[model samples]
Target chain A: MAKFDISNIDRRWIYITILLGALLPLFVPITFAPKISPEVKAVYDYIDKLPPGSVILLSFDYGPSTLPETEPMAEDIMKHAFINGVRVIGISLTEEGALLALKAYSNVVKEFENYGTIRVNYGYDFVFLGYKSGRQAVILSIGEDIRKTFPTDYQGTNIDDIPMMFNVKNYKDISLVVDISSTNTPNDWITYAYSRYKVPVAVGVTAVLAANYYPFIQTGQIIGLIGGVKGASEYEYLVNQKIQSNWGMKPKRIPAMRNMSALTVAELLIVLFIILGNIGYFSQKGNKRR
Target chain B: MAISSSIWVWIAAFLTLAVFSFLYKDNIIYKMVEALFVGVSAGYSIVIILKHSFVPNIWKPLFVSHNLLYLIPFLLGLLFFAMLSRKTAYLTHIPFAFLIGSGAGFALPLVFQTNVMAQVKGTMLFAPSHYPSLGAFINALIIFIGVLTVLFYFFFSRGEKTNRGIIVKTGIAFIMIGFGASFGYTVMARLSLLVGRLYFLFGTWLGILH
Candidate 1:
């Protein structure tokens, strides 16, 4: 047997172990039912309480790189909103998030039909103001007047032509502004939208950024946060629970929930490696001292 | 298990595998994909901006509608290109000044309110009287202590030699907690991204997961 040395171990071997740890759960699935955290429930509760036809301004502020985290969060929220008859006005802060938002909306809307829930019309019930440049400037503009910022929806149909546009003029008309972000755009929402316009803001942030927002949540600047894939899984569980109870069927696919198993096993494996590496380091140091 | 037949799925799977090939070693395939990603991103941005902003907001309204009012901002925006010439370079500052001025004019008060006043209020409002339960009181007290200590850690991160008091040590502990939480979350996030790709390959592409 080769002598085991922590410092001299092949990087490939470690990478392979981690990869196997992540991959094994996908093959023989380990189900992890996410426990809804207080922060996540705060967001869910806020959205859950909105009256039918109330508009949720969902800013898709993430790119494809974070689709694993943000996309499911967006989809879960949109599904909840649709299921509750709460309309969503999807916009994108990041350029890539524009198309990503459109894709998410389309996916949810397709599934919405089968829920046999209330009809979700494109122009009337929901509308996408789409991507506009000048991220902070666009957010501030939307605070003042959304129509001036986005003359047309993503499809280039004038906002005046859209039925829902008549009722939604600015932040005042929005029931909630949920910025799903992997960027600092949520900070802009917190500062501009919530601070100036006094609109309630919630964030669905990538897990890495979640720590940054805990203080903001404490200050009540943000109503709640859905932090990363784990947060998304918790949210999916919550949404599916309510949705299933109401309709007697869970949402067809739970991607984020599936992700939890891999996330758990991978973390556990990495922790074990870290512990073993530390033990080996101390043991080697003791030998040197001797 | 059946393999995915869709061309898009095949393209995506191939690109994903190509990117993952970096774990072994940096090769031409990775380089090619990296360049391809950048080019596609740049091209995508141009198409989105032109289709969404320039066309609807400026181009159509200026030329088709013959709206001369749009020309003011348009001409100001064009001055940004003046940076190409030495003498005309200073002209770029005109629009830059407007942008900065207007942005500051709008943002100054709001930023103060959100970042300062709100945060301060959240911190300072942690009185024991406000808490109805022992647990709530302890949580609030802990938060109050954590916020104060961590605020000082910001100065510590700048390499300032503050007084070596228990307060500073406490702040260091709070900072470590924050860092640990952040690191743990980052690990979960990166792992989730990997899980996503692995699932795409195994479940979506190969159908082996089923």
Candidate 2:
């Protein structure tokens, strides 16, 4: 057989392969049914069971750098809340996340409008409290008084003027707290919100950080977690399932679902590269032995 | 292929391609976009910090709301800039002391409650009689063993000869498995980001995919 060499393979070729793996899937649509993990299910079930008009706090704690992994989870969770008639109180602990929070809200609200059934009015049904400094201090203060921490919403509108803020004074009024983050904000939430106020906490984090939070989940400090794109896809699947079953609504195609095929292709390419590299190493070792 | 009509979409597409060009080789386009991104991000962060945090919490409270108590924090914050001046740098120490002291004091109890006590409680292998199940028993046992082994692996106080026990070997295995899983998840995370960018290029900017 012709000599098989992976060691000398051009790096550009690998890049092209990866690019193709990511790009081709967009042209040929493929659907992936995510195996919804227990953690993801817990999040879905908790939000699903919340009473109508219950206030849910969403802390967007990521920047544009993590938008891909974080945004889908944010969108899906917001959609679920809106569909379930749950009031959303949005906040961002990170400066970069402030714009992202608004974008996520706007995207979900636009999609919700397409349903033409549930009307969501800004400052009434939902509000974005925007970014705050003193990360841990802000979180602790919010546990005591949200209005005190955020005197006004993102648009410079007074919190007192917002109808949704009427009952939401602190974590006491909130049903659940979901933080979508690329950093250690979830840990802060667990330490401050859950440990102190006994508020239910959930997190949607990048996959790399997901493993670190399992200990928190095991301790029941975090009610649920949705990690990275797979987690986002699973959540999207759950939300779509709920909307379909409850309202008999047609499920809209979400970004997470669309991008999963590309992820699969990229993963397969990586695996292939790993196998090839190993084969090359072994083959060279055998030659040396000769 | 159908192209986009929107000027913003074209701009986004151009920027995406410019950034992606770094995969082949770094060029002026990539450098320009990178600088633009950094400049925009820094400028935006300053604006947001001023509008949301400083204005609402410090400025408005001090001036508009006339909450005199806010002046303390306001002054402390201003002292942060004092570090730039050699003469006034001593003032920075006061705020730094207060910050470090208060932060540690606040975080101490909370960290102990969540990270220490809660983690220890979660590692308890002895299950209560009410929720007796074989699966739970096995899972708890595994977790308990894993935690101990992992901890033992990091115990460098013991001599190498003493630490070469079967328990240490098992700890190595568990650590390896943990590392492998982390590696796998990290790969997944990176691929997800790539998929996201491709989707944006094709689905959003190009509008060729549905």
lDDT of 2 by residue, B1-210 (tens): 466788998888898899989988989999999999999989998998887777777777799989999989889988999989999899999899999999999999999999999999999877545346787678778889998987877883276667376777788899898899899989998888787777778778777776
Instruction: Give lDDT: candidate 1, residue A126.
Output: 77
- Cα lDDT tens digits, model 1, A1-290, are 97878856788888899999999888787888877899999999999999988999999999988888999999999889888888889898778988898899887877877777756789876788888878878888887888889888877798999988888899889999999999999889998888878899999999989999988987789999999999999999999999879978867778888888888999998998889889888999999999
Name the docking class for model 1.
Answer: high
Q: Tens digits of per-residue lDDT for model 2 on A1-290?
A: 97657776888999899989888777887778889999999999999999999999999999887787899999999889988889899999998898888898888878777877778888877899888888899889998888778888888788998988987888889999999999999999999999999999999999999998988887799999999888999999988888788778877667887777788888899999999989889988998999
TM-score of each: 0.94, 0.94
For model 2, state the Cα shift of residue B165 in Å: 2.0
